[model samples]
Target: MALDSYDLYVVIILVVAVAAYFAKNQFISKPESTGFLSNDSNGGTNSRNILETLQKNNKNALLVYGSQTGTAEDYSNKMSRELSSRFGLKTMVADFADYDWDNFGDIKDDILVFFILATYGEGEPTDNAIEFIEFLDNEADTLSSLRFTVFGLGNSTYEFYNAIGRKVDLKLEEKGAERFAEYGEGDDGKGTLDEDFLSWKDGVFDSLRNNLNFEEKELKYEPSLKIIERDELTTEDKQVSLGEPNKKYINTSVGTDLSKGPFDHTHPYLAPITKIKELFNSKERSCVHVEFDISDSNLKYSTGDHLAVWPQNSNENIEIFLKAFDLNDKKDNVIELKALDSTYHIPFPTPITYEAIIRHHLEISGPVSRQFFLSIAAFAPNEETKTKLTKIANDKSKYAEEITLKKYNIADALLYLSSGEPWTKVPFEFLIENIQHLTPRYYSISSSSMREKSNINITAVVESEIEKDKRIVSGVVTNLLKDIEINKNKSGDKPLVTYDLKGPRSKFENFKLPVHVRRSTFKLPSSSKTPIILVGPGTGVAPLRGFIRERITQLENDVNVGPSLLFYGCRNENEDYLYKDEWKEYSKKLGENFEIVTAFSRADPSKKVYVQHKILENSAKINEFINNGAIIYVCGDAAHMARDVQQAFIKIISNERKIDLEKAADLVRSLKVQNRYQEDVW
Candidate 1:
């Protein structure tokens, strides 16, 4: 058909417009995905299908981690590096939350899977592993072709230690999956987690060598990450992260409402410290009572929930770490980190500075691990220092005396070893790989949600340990809270430690803290009429206080409440007695129904009185309450006090029921199973 001049012009115009639209869409930047790498690029789209990811990436080994505080993830990465570098295996690390479990049976027999699971509170899997655990319980398909091994990280103090790990191992075998190695467990309660892991790893490698005919190569340090120093980007650059947790906080201005929905471990709310006061009167010891305002945000918490506070490293520790690593000069220089291996992932967001990494990302002030010493010895400043480090690492007694007993962190150990010489030869990537990412510290909520619905209260004792040489080892979060207490109260005296209370770019200025609420099963009965016997000594009284307050609030609301008993212990009434006057007020509110048994250990210098002694003193009453369907709640030191309290309860039951000790123990175990006896011990 013949076209006129106007028709021809219209056709050309339409073609030009279409081309312009395509070019604009191509140039626009897309949102970055948070998925990890299965190959050279991130497996964002395919991360949900584990079998496909493994087949597409050509990986023979997969390390899946279910971590709560990043320990399991770190262990998985360590194992992945070792497998890749030492055994020449293609490996990839996967988070339990990222993958689908339906493809487990579809994975080829040649691929090996490693389950690095950490058991959380009360025989539960971690938050990320919850879905996977549910899937394992409900899945009908048998994973007969799967070959796997399990390593669990847990504290032995709990009754269900490494429960998730054991369950996974047993379930996998039940589903016809083959186990290539014996199940391994690490005990943090005994402080032997590092040594246990090393021993277990040796056994696993032996099994691999014998069964799979795998050959081991000479061990060498191979960095999984590539560090790129961005000289052009300064700390002042808007794109750079100077301790900001995520990209959304990169250029966020002060006073902006950054609180969105779905606050959890990954995202935190910048809450303001509404109130602060000292609970102790002693000069040597201090306890702080802090209140955080959650009214402005969508955060909600119950009476016995936990509050997770994300703290930053103090300036003093930051400087020491930077100086020890010879990064003081380049601390402020912006840098970008990229994983060299497809399996590895950068721990934190990149375009960050060394100072920010030290201050906010890596745990620089924790006790140095023997394995870490061995790993970093090759990069020591000189031969003498290397030899010294190697000797200390190899000798258990020497390591205990010099590193553990002295409470030396990485910086402290390095400085003492080299006589203040910087470890310049050590690669930054090695440090990043070896050191663990700083995790949040959880504190028991000490306020009743009924009374103060929008405010969360925390009662924490500032923990400080004095070494043999009189060096003070400070608890990172507690000291940070102390600093906040001092700064807020305008106390002229210097704090035990200093922190940049004005957080990244002053976003956390004016006494603000990065915090989130973690739901806890520890709670009072749904009915106010249910009696509760609380045994808590020292800071263990925190949640107990919440229980008491909840009762008081109920009383004020004209609700009938049952009898309440609190067994509390401390040094003396004049010193470390927490909430002394407040307890009296609470007693007034519930006269004849409330009672408190005090155990002042230091009141009588010759004969110490403790909570267990008081428990025995009220044995008949406790037994009576138990018979009346009262719940027993214990919170305190998990190692000694909790065990002692439990034993005391068993004794009381033995005497009350005229039964044997074993029978009484069974009764207590039944109480636990029935949820009548609860523990919030650490």
Candidate 2:
């Protein structure tokens, strides 16, 4: 029988779809054997019997991930697994940075490309995905045949929220790529990054099934790599297994030459911990105040800025990581790595020991992923164990409620789920390949450059708690800083927690922390002619203090000064209030130009009020400041405090200016786009 043009077109499309599926599975299955490029080494080969038809059809679905931390990469891998196991689709999760774009235009029309892009650092592309971002921005025309979907991760509090995701979506469209589903955006600020992704992804999967006529494939256990034992090693040999590369590398060494500009992603300056104090007297919940000395470095900053601190895992956590990866015996073994591309920078310099890897390279303490569970299934000691691991990995609701929602890290999760099998069998290479590199954390620069140009100050609340599930949790950076403080403050006797006091790569000697300044748009009115209202509670006062100090310095230097008002809040006046005496000097210089209100939530017999209440009381003056071109700024917690303060501002505009709710909202929105209403919330 002769075929018509319409029939021929349909046949071609089906052929292309099948070919794409096979190509995807061929790329994703196994590691070196598959030629698939990924940062993760846990590449498992799916069972041939389960996916024979899909493999034979040669249909490939491309999954690309732009990950900053490992979350996006992990999610991409999960999607790839879902495609292969559930819908009988052959899929590969391509690392966006590593994927070649030259032939994107030639992709099979039936092939579906999934993009998991994460926004990092003021909407900038992640360090590993920078090239991919630049490519899409510059050579978007190359994606004419691509059928794609994108999911972006970002916090709404930032000015450029999910900017990379939005830009990628727009750029791809401009380049002629057809989107299969609506581009998805997940807000980390709203604590719904996971839910948003899951919800959006369901629709995407449904679309793929309808478009391609995909059928479900039963899942089976697949182990990426194997853990084999080497015999004939004694205790002494095991002690030296990590080799000599690690012995010479001290954590503080990375920043030894900060005076000379060797500072980069891996190497950081070990600035001295000049000062440390508790923001509150209460032992239950206390914030740590810290100061870093940069008198010798050329690092300079303004009033509103951020300081990125390079941190190391605590020795206890390091030990836990080594044990979990089954590398404790080879604690001193040396290792090296080569990046496939120039853009693939090692998290840090390698040729180091297991201890260094544990302390610096691996993000060993994060929550476990389904992929992790699936990867470890084959390594289970017995059949029952394998079934249990597989169940945990495959069951989304069970995994979420028992694992992710409970905030369980790998070690605790393994212990709870595995019945204390001791996780001493997981391989070291698997960890280095699967887990993400530790990234630097940013803190608001609480000190003003005008007040102390050569110095930087930071405030953080130490997070240590026993949750409802009875799991102990600690903030990685804050706890590390606290340990440093304790070590420095120790007297003649040995300190309680011995953290190898010197960091890996010798980057931090004398327990000084590594830090670099990151600039912020949340700045003072450049002219100083605009009156300003500042509302901040607790550590939120950090940047506001900078503004106050900057304005004070400007007035002293014969610069024009404007009226300034600050509503600062804390638990008590005598304890948690920061920059107390400095505010007095600041107020004296400005006179009526400066107005300060203090709210002590735990001080009075009437149980404590907050800064939002204080704003309502002084609604008249606030209205006057607003009318006279006042720029309002709020800094602190976005979850509750920032929103409450925002609501208070809306109320002030409505009650004091006697405007309708809608008009008041418009005024706030206008101020927002004008940069007059700024927030530096985390």
List the candidates' TM-scores in order: 0.92, 0.76
Candidate 1: tens digits of C-alpha lDDT, residues 1-682: 9999999999999999999999887775343224221112342345566788788778999999998877888788788878887798899988888677776788867999999999997688988898899988997378899899999998888877889999999998999899988899999889888888878888889988998989998767888788898998887788888887666577566775677645666667889998999999988888999999988888888999999998788887888888998888888888888776654556677788888888988888888888788878889999999999899999988999988888899999999999899999999888888888888899999999999998999999988767676656788899999999998998775777789889878888999988888888898998899989999999999999999999999999999999999999999989999999999999999997799999999999999999999999998999999999999999989878888899999999999999999999999989988889999988
lDDT of each: 0.86, 0.69
Question: How far is 415's C-alpha from truth in model 2 (Å)?
Answer: 1.1
Off by over 4 Å in 1: 1-46, 251-257, 466-470
Candidate number of the best TM-score: 1
Q: Lowest-scoring 10 consecutive residues by lDDT in candidate 1?
A: 35-44
- Local error of candidate 2 at 177, Å? 2.0
Model 1: clashing residue pairs? none
Q: Tell me the lDDT of model 2 at 655.
A: 89
Writing each residue's lDDT as its tens digit, candidate 2 over 1-682 gives 9999999999999999999999997766432211111222222332322123223435477677887556787677567666766776666555654444544666755678888989875567876577677666676466677788899988886657999999988888988888988899889887778668777877887776786566656554322333333334332342322211222222224544446443433334567888876566664665777889888877677778888786566666666555555667777645545543222223333444567667765666666666667666656656776787778777878888878888877766766666766665555555655565566777888888988887888888777776786545777788777766666766243322345556533446676776666567889987887899999888888888878878888888988899889999998888777777878988888878888999999899777699999998998998898899899999888767877887888899998878897899788878888878888776
